[model samples]
Target: SNSALDEIVHRIITAGLTDAKGETYIPSIVRVGVNAHHSISSVSMDSLVALRVESSDRAKGKRRLEKDRARIAILDESSIVASTLAFSGCSMFSRMTRTFDVVVVDEAAQAVEPSTMVPLCHGCQQLFLVGDPIQLPATVLSDRAKDHGYDHSLFKRFQTAGYPVSVLNVQYRMHPAIRSFPSREFYDEGLEDGPNVVADTERPWHKHACYGPFAWLDVRGKEFTPEGSGSKANRDEAEAALALVKDLMVRFTELREPGLMAVISPYKEQVRLVKSLFRDKLGAEIAQGIDVNTIDGFQGREKLVAIFSGVRADDKKGIGFVRDERRMNVGLTRGRSTMIVLGSARVLRKAGPWRRLVRDAKARRALFPFTRPFDKSIARLTSDTYKVEDEVYSEEGEDEEWEDDEDDEQDVDYGAESEPEGDWIPRAEPGMSDDYSDSGRA
Candidate 1:
């Protein structure tokens, strides 16, 4: 949607003109989404980090000082710099401003507290506030607004907030399978009529296989495992996910630096587990970009092989993975080639407000265009296929030969049990397409 939306906007303004005679679309939407419901220029990342610390502060409290100084082993430079919101001797608020060609605020309703934007919108003018107010507003301002010296109701704030606001009446992001949920939960004005939003219920569940080599790990078995008992049962899931990653290494010999895989968990400690595992096995992994979290992790990056290890099942249990629906979706869609969900969906339901309105089967059918299987007659990590050209191959000096298997191994097998790289498949290997090659790095 990001690229396509930009392309459409460009086309709309320029009449879709290019160097060619006919109209064509070009995506020129350069965007930088500085994380927050608040204004980008008004806020700073350090301010947000400090806000997190301030949120845990007590109205009347001070730290009890221990007489004995703890052992200080200086690894990196240790210092307390001025926070973005607080101007200290080491820092200035104006120096930390981030600039972008195009700036837009997503989910503006959630940014009710103007204080969050006070440090960000110091110079922001070009801004776009986007979201549905029917759902929810910012928690900070919504709660204890009188104490913050504000008396405006949320409805009034919604009516008068922002400058030059526009509504995205046309819904486009959701798959048709689950649009109804958002319609009920979010869309107050509802969707504008359009053919782009269509349904295809005819596709069978098995017909729409997931993006390969996708695998869903079940950690539901460890839902009731006792934690903080000094045992590693809680840590077992992280360890198992690491084991799967190692299995991938042994299974795929051609796994290059970029192909080693990543582990994504909503939890930071689980991410630490992945880093430690990589350190214990391979050296300090530079490419193991798995710990990209719900907070500032994988917006501008992707991995070819993603192993999502931390799937939290128990909502009340505290260590469960899925903390937010949007965060889970971000993790789910991060895979460029393959997305391996290495945890149980059952376990994450324990987190309250877990509403899976659309079953995965239905959602996939509505999203993907082609539900066809990968061509069997392909070879290598390259996703190419032989067209069954003449049912024979006589290239080079070799004699013409039919693809019919030998008298013994005549049965073609392309089952799930078979390794995709192996030549024991039902079809013979094909010539590589220009875009594809012997290596599966792409």
Candidate 2:
């Protein structure tokens, strides 16, 4: 229930404001599909819970589910707000209440199943469903639905029932490169053609002396589904990812902008493993005390130099949970300059929709070579070396455990690696060159 509803109550109660540190405290829904969560168990399969509820279906005819534990807790106070998977015309939510002041539904796409929401619609006067249908529609994934798809989930159904509705169109999510395709696919038609190579630079940022803050590689990785839902990413891949991390350290030293680089991936396990190994081996060289965050974490932030960790197979299946196309868009957009994905062309080829985007991105990057730097790129890889430990989450109290007292963030900069002056040429197509067709992030 980290839905917008829950965030509002949590922030208003804890921070005493509707906004905290600039994050909107307004009621909304939240679902980090996967990867950001260190544990696969982080997200709930409430669809399964709905089945459980139906089989046992306790609180039978109980009228008010406000007391139900299905929704997560946000505030300890009298009046509270929560996100419900329940949807339009669901009777359980219609009751006039001393129970809640307002209710919102997060993951509105998932909540689109009207049958599951039948109970909540009964008691609530104010209801809202906030989700992007373009990301993933709420319907059976049949070719039939794919052929005749429509956006009319419960929220859309409410509009069909004659309720006045609102649409929030500002996309505060992706970088211009990654956002372009999804926007064209789901948003403004005018937003169709992708990437802004010269918008911010003088007369031509595209070729303006080729600023070195760039790295683009057509990546590839092996394909093998892990044993269980909770299984970790391939350890061999993790070790290779560490080598890439070390390479980034070298790049950061060249750029001398240690504080300006970031490492993004689609997998949380990759993030944990890379961060732990990088810290243990080169703790003194990291930008600062900041731990690695995945693409979702780096969203609103841009880096002068970016080191993207590619842990997916090259053919296509991209990485992590890609049931929704929106995630692929998010991953590609993490870097402003320099994005290096280290997977095989085979994996990218395997990802049908993703292949199109990768092809497009590589083509766009090739049309203009200097956009992101990949020159002087070198990788030293060795596998089956150290057995990566079970992923660990640093506790709040132990945040300082990784800190280096003698090291300041600025001291870690690798001078020459940051600039454009070396004989070392950057590769537009690094690993998965065979499949890239030269499409890359702008």
Candidate 3:
């Protein structure tokens, strides 16, 4: 997960920073984000984890490390080069008076007030801090830190200070149906679909029309706790989500583009379980293409379909992390066309935000009760491909098998892809095209 951000910086530097001749044009680009590792063994370009430029010799080679440090110190305003570094990376050169034309902070809401101000102190003419305050906030764990206002981000503070702010109204991701609720609830009905986008109400992709755009499969009675993870895993929910994936694949078999989908959970353990289920039921190719991650993972990204698995079912525990409204906003707004949510409605209704969402869903008839078990016939095509396991939990030692080596960290970068704007989204660096738009991080 930590390497996810690193991987994005790598891609942006490698793929996005090219000139008209299709060559690396930037005189220099530096990445200062702090992540656990530089490279990921089984990294996906769509991963939610973050990447950082390591300056420590123990982390990277001496030659490369020195090069990175030098990139931050370079203050050539005349040269058409870009430097990417973390706030701390800039702090390393505090003794030297360095300045630039502009400084763009990608996830401004995730940066605390002080750190965000460091880059602004440089004599920059224009400042662009892009982030959605309604989504995830800066990760502040300690109570002492909260008391000191470490949880308050500079973006939110700036917005509250009556700074000139522009909200992007048109979103290119989720189907209008799925986007409607979050747009109404969080954005004051500011989000709209792109002009070229046509969201079908009925099943244009399926021969037999089915309920669309939004679907809720209630798995109230079918969740259980796994042995060692100390987290709940719902076999019924997992099976149902996989079955939905199968149905989508078969229904949209003729589509030109790959069926983009995601299975999102609020917990890493549930993420692992869903990923395992996807692989075991579907296969490797399908699993790789479909992102399985936490709500934070889908931040700043959108997909054609999003299947949310609310893993917590215990009435007493009160739905755990899903109770947070900000997280719900991120989870609900990730899909561009369809959002199929699997959870215990009875349990979710206990939370105020989810209750309002459930109420809205019921009023719209987007809610579908999980009265019957998963339809085996719905997956007849995939039945021959792989056998569905009856057991919920993975075997001993198998749980650890799927665990990645992202290291234990609370906050990691989850970079989202910007839709190709006839070519590429403009970078924050100088000497680049000034045209750019909000990519809708939430």
Question: What TM-score do all the candidates reach, one by one?
Answer: 0.41, 0.44, 0.66
lDDT of 2 at 124: 49
**lDDT tens per residue, model 3, 1-442:** 2323443444454444544555444233343333323232223211211133333445457655555444434432122222232433455445444455666676678767876776656556777898888888987667699998888988888898999887877876556777788888888888888875553323454222122577666666555656765556677778777777776777576321343577887766677778888788877766766777777755666556678888766655545566677888988876656677888777776666676776777666555555344665344313445332321221232212111222223422233221111111111333443233322111
The candidate that achieves the highest lDDT relative to the unseen native structure: 3
Worst 10 residues of 2 by lDDT: 416-425
Clashes of 3: 17
Instruction: Give the winner by lDDT: 1 or 2.
Output: 2
The most accurate candidate by TM-score is 3
Q: Can you rank all candidates by TM-score, best first?
A: 3, 2, 1
Q: State the displacement of the C-alpha of residue 381, model 1, in Å, after optimal TM-score superposition.
A: 17
How high is the CA lDDT of each candidate model?
0.35, 0.39, 0.58
